[model samples]
Target chain A: MTEPHDLPSAAELVEAVREFLAHDVLPAVDGRVQFHTRVAVNVLGMVGRELALGPAQAAAHGEGLAALGVSSEAELARIIRQGGADDRMDDIGRFVRATVRAKLEVANPKYLAE
Target chain B: MSDGGRDAEPAALLRSVLDAPIENLRRLSGGASRETWSFDCGGRPLILRRDPPGAPKEGMAVEARLLRAAGACGVPVPEVVAAESSFIVMERVEGETIPRKILRDDAFAAARPALAAQCGTVLAALHRIPVEDFADLPDTDQVAEWRDILDSLGQPHPAFELGLRWLGENRPPRSGTTVVHGDFRNGNLIVGPEGVRAVLDWELAHRGDPLEDLGWLCVKAWRFGVNDKPVGGFGDYDELVGAYEDAGGGHVDRDALMWWQAMGTLKWGIMCIVQGSLHVSGTVRSVELAAIGRRVCENEWDLLDLLPYGRD
Candidate 1:
């Protein structure tokens, strides 16, 4: 049961992870610790962002795409690969937003290392 | 790892300019098309940017040209000191990347408007540069660009296809063209006490519709989780637009900005997919790189929602 307020802000989580790695992880590592640090920090930051809004963002995107006659994640994924949407009469901005939103959902769980 | 082969040329060149001996060199993560490194030369700092192995010979030259163009335009960009086919030596700006810090900090929420406004102003200035100065640069046609990018990836995302078709049918006539910063956003800006110190990574610079830069800044992907606040999650949409207008960017229509924003997200999504494929196929490997590929879906979904046709 994660309450809204209980959830760490993306920045907070990222900072915590960054601090831990710098103080704890780096001192213990042997080869190319700096390289590992950069990778870890970057991934942490990205994960924090995803944790903040990935699910809601994805749902919003899926809804928008569905409105454009795209129903499933798989279908939307295909449309994204093709690089265009079906509807021309509609606003391009709105269509792009929805499409990106849906895609964000797919990446969210992946970011958490799930 | 030490610089092998021609990669050592930048350090050698830089050593000639600086008084100190080169101590250590390490590659910094971020650039996909080029190699970026931070090195110590006689206890002083320097950055080396070079084309990756197997990159075309012309790539470094193009980068130099774009950096020169950006400097002429009054953009806060790194000064290019020297360049060759293998590498370019430049002064590195000191600051945390805007995306790396600003997006996650609630303390910086108040500064969001200011940051976004600054971004707008910077973009407006970048766009004001004369296109003819970079005449040999190729123009990116929206439809053709999308098709080409998708074909290159070989991943059939229906959302992308739909987006391409929708954009083709609904493509707005180009309002005006200028020097476009193809990827202007939070991650690319180096923010310091003096405000945005430098706009780094000009590899994608080109001559195209000015809105391309605007759209890229406002793209949801760059929002870094603060999607509610437009302008790279720093401020409201109106504030950013107003800042650009104040900076002498003439006649910006909100509708036009929105259109560009969607396009920006779509383009980014495709790039992510392509990058992801590269990682998956073993062309490159790294958690961050693979993660970026996974992130493409978010951009695609964002683009889908921004367009009217996708509305319920």
Candidate 2:
């Protein structure tokens, strides 16, 4: 079964739109619209990053939870909330730090260094 | 105030209050629930703060009184020239309200170093204001309030639940009640080269433990990326506590303050979700609010950092 339509990938298309907003649309606007355009561009960049990194990041998170003996993130969270992780905060800390870093990779990578 | 038709113009109603003609009555920035207008009367700039038209005016009424009470207690606030049930007419204080500018601007270099201490002193004064007259203000448990708010969102925020549980287990012994400026932080404080010029947005004012205000100031979310300085990204926690004590504030319990910081981070994260829900639920579609929703992860990261863990 040969599938037909192939040109710019979804990520590539998003990148193109992001560049257009940043280079062309951004400098052309001012005040509220300009501000919102910047946000829009940021949102696009986030979408692109998510498209690129989301699957692996999700898998890594699941593995991290599994390593903590929790089957899912929700279970890990519930167990932690219930103080079941109180004795093993070291593990929880490492897991949370790694998890948050992965999220920052998509949300705003600049903040990771900060 | 005249009990005129609901459709009556605000300008006309204000004209009766001000003897001189009003000019340049334009709407300033406000949220969906509130209205802020700037106008000039008798060659003086004035601000009109009111609830959105047709909404109940009770909160504005309390805020007007709070401003006056705060001023009386030596806390810097906009002077309320005239107040009615519907709106408050205050002398517009000119200053920078943006936190980033106050934190990073070389123009505010002189004021930056002193801000944390200044905040302590001002907050002490605000807390000393007698709360007996604010009977209408509701007293609610801060932790329970946030838990309810988060639960109401119907979102499974495991980090929030974890944070909430931590707070519940480590609940601090209640400090003495005081008039608290609930939203006391960088953005709410109008900063100038001299120092904090005035406090703005008293809508969140209430009676609570004075330390709640101190803890809220240290919330990593409010630090605006300058997390190195725990006190609004400008000064240290000990420095904030020292200044507060010097200004007649009660004792500082470091553990309690840290607990509140963790709680405040979760509180802010939950607030971001709520703001995003307004966009998600089609109540108020806003890109800005939706973007804030993405920042909740930042709070989660901060929570893990702040919580007592293996580092201890």
Candidate 3:
């Protein structure tokens, strides 16, 4: 293997475990077990997507914050709460929408599609 | 799904109250706060709503009174059988409360065409009830209340901040104060082929602006991913407004409703934070609540769409 952790990379391993639960365990279970198994599957799926997309998303998210001239999300939030951003509503709105989109990309991209 | 020998204490509570043998007691899923159990008592299908141990009992008693008040106003609601501080027994409502099923299932297709109007009519009827009659209901200044809640949660959600600012700045003058069904939405409705069978979940009922219920109903979360249909993914906004006005509700102001809608979306986003905090604080550990934390942005997306600042 090229790195310290051998072949089935972190993302690949999460996918393998998720698939095992979804395909092997989900079908055989019913009621509470079935529901929890599905949730577990979804959790892993989200983690896998984050591993694949998080780094680039972090970069894009920084750009989004820069568009609003805020150093951190908390600062942006405080400015809006205090009405300091009212004059620049259009710019702030654009930045908010883009960042929310990226967040859903990790959380649930289906939300963005709709 | 009869869970025999489980929930033994709750079953005993039912037996003592009804003085009849309880059978086929099984817990119903999907309620976030209250325990809902279905049981047969004296040849009647009843639902028992119990607060978790040590929780306040006054809420259940107040909810029972509100159900009767709404029913008196011709709103379809479950009939309360018996209500104590910690528990309430009501006639079990039989219909689907799941949004996706109510939106997609064939049985609801016919109901879908009429639900929006029915919802409007029902809300109008509900709003007609005298506010003074509900002496126990608390007044909620929602825009301010939710902001305080998000601030206390200490999580920075910028989208929520933007929407909250917009709502506060463009606050509409109060047209009327009425009985607002705070949690009225698609999922909280019991829908059948005929239409809405009963309105469930009155825990959030309060005294607020009459338009609040309508605005809350149209919140996109209740639409279940269907963006086109604005009113619960069932009927048009015109149908809802028309029916509401026709049913003795005052003139439906579009701008006021839109403002409330934006406010509703932000309130929901903050509520998601509160729910997630329950998990984070280890007060309640469940996958459902944890999953809701990530779902906050869904409402943020909807909130931004509602505000016309930067239309995408």
For every prediction, compared with the true complex, DockQ reads 0.26, 0.54, 0.70
Residue B205 lDDT in candidate 3? 85
Name the better of 2 and 3 by lDDT. 3
How many steric clashes does model 2 contain? 0
- DockQ, prediction 2: 0.54
* Candidate 2 residue pairs in clash (backbone atoms < 3 Å): none
Candidate 3: share of reference interface contacts reproduced: 0.76
Fnat per model, in the order shown:
0.55, 0.53, 0.76
Against the true structure, what is every candidate's RMSD?
A: 8.6, 2.4, 3.8
| Chain B superposition TM-score per model | 0.87, 0.95, 0.92
Q: Candidate 3, which CAPRI tier? A: medium
Model 3 bad stretches (over 4 Å): A1-3, B1-8, B19-21, B30-32
Number of the top-ranking candidate, with lDDT as the measure: 3
Model 3, range B1-312, lDDT digits (tens) per residue?
332123347887787678878999998864655788899987889998887665544587788888888889899998998877667889988899999999999988899999999999998998987789896788878888988888899899988887887788789899798988898899889999999889988888889899999988888887887768889888788999999999999888999999988888888888898888889889999887788888898889889888766665
In model 1 chain B, which range of ten residues has the least summed lDDT? B1-10
lDDT of 1 at B117: 81
Q: Rank the candidates by DockQ, best first.
A: 3, 2, 1
